[model samples]
Target: MPSIQKPLTKRAWVRLPSGRRLNLLDPTPFDFEADDLALGAARTVRWGGHSVWEWPLSVAQHSLTVLAIGEAEAPRPLTAAQKLAFLLHDASECLGVCFDPISPLKPFLGEGYRQLDQALQTAVHRRFGLPADLPPAWKKPIKTADKRAAAAEAIFVAGWSLAECREALGIRAAPLSADPLTPIYGGLPWEPWPARIAAERFGAALAGLAGSMP
Candidate 1:
């Protein structure tokens, strides 16, 4: 089967030791390029889990959530730039996952996806003028919030039983309707959430982060 083609500039491709390639655009060359790449990539997908119509959450929305959580949990004050970095954290996934979660191909996810994702992340950070390596101190909090989001998602969106989730996560499940899961991608019928809605959710989460700051 022929794969879908994405438009790319030659400068975007950088060679790796393993002979793999990456997209590492020069940050200063384009204005708002990071945002543009992220926003554009969010519109499509490579692989996503089974849900209503085999749908999955979009990277754009997820990045927004991460930003919200970062703002809410970051111990030290973050500049506007840092906040943007947080929101666009998963920008690489905007293109597609290095590997997607699914049966028959699940094993590829462990090391293959990890290396690719890390490279993409490094490239994105360098492109956006952020540090190449994530600071160690911030790691745990970000990961914790990510897991909490996962837990919340399993109960609300994936149709997991509360008892099953409780046994897995060791926490009582709460009412899911209050924080109803919004589908990032549309179904085969193609009923997607509005881009404005995605932006709004992102903005609100970013605001919440500010509120959580000391």
Candidate 2:
């Protein structure tokens, strides 16, 4: 009789601060907690820990910035769901245990990472009562706002030149009055907030948006 062999299982789990383990490769349906998002995002650094700020800018702060930009740049007022979607646009990044620039990794990692990323994003959307996919009309403004936010982040926090950042992000140079280094959106300055404060503010914003649901 030949010896029977069992295949080895690859580990693809990330443990949350809440002690919950998520299998990133094949995540099971799980409830998304606002606390987990707030805390995790607050700790996740933007620019892959390469920011020029005194402390790394947290994803929580980045989310608030994007939401603010989306609201300010939208042609009309956005509904609660739209606002939530904007805030959570990068929520999937918080679920990952490490940071890898997606653009650079895509060619090597291929579609598998993208599928996992989308699954995490859909999970986040469902958790907050948003549709898994945003309508086409809404996506444009959100994406534009997101790019503007990225342009500002690159210039201010990541120490990139204005021309270079704009070119890389495909955004127009900021107006003289709207200095890229000192950009303001939604009447809020683009400065990095403390991690704890960012987490608290994110939770508050999430609560307000969730409460507004009919």
Candidate 1 achieves a global lDDT of: 0.50
Model 1 quality (TM-score): 0.57
* Segments of candidate 2 deviating more than 4 angstroms: 1-3, 8-11, 28-31, 96-102, 167-189
Give one digit per residue, the lDDT tens place, for model 2 in 68-163: 877777778989999998888888877754343534456787687788778888878877788889899878877777677767777777788888
TM-score of candidate 2 against the unseen true structure: 0.83
Evaluated at residue 116, the lDDT of candidate 2 is 78
Pairs clashing within candidate 2: none
What lDDT does candidate 2 reach at residue 17? Answer: 68
lDDT tens per residue, model 1, 1-214? 9999998654556443234444544323222233344443455332254334334555555565555556666788777656756765565554323233432355656885666666666666665556677676655666655555555555555556678777854545242332323343333222224445554555455455434543
Winner by lDDT: 2
RMSD of 2: 3.5
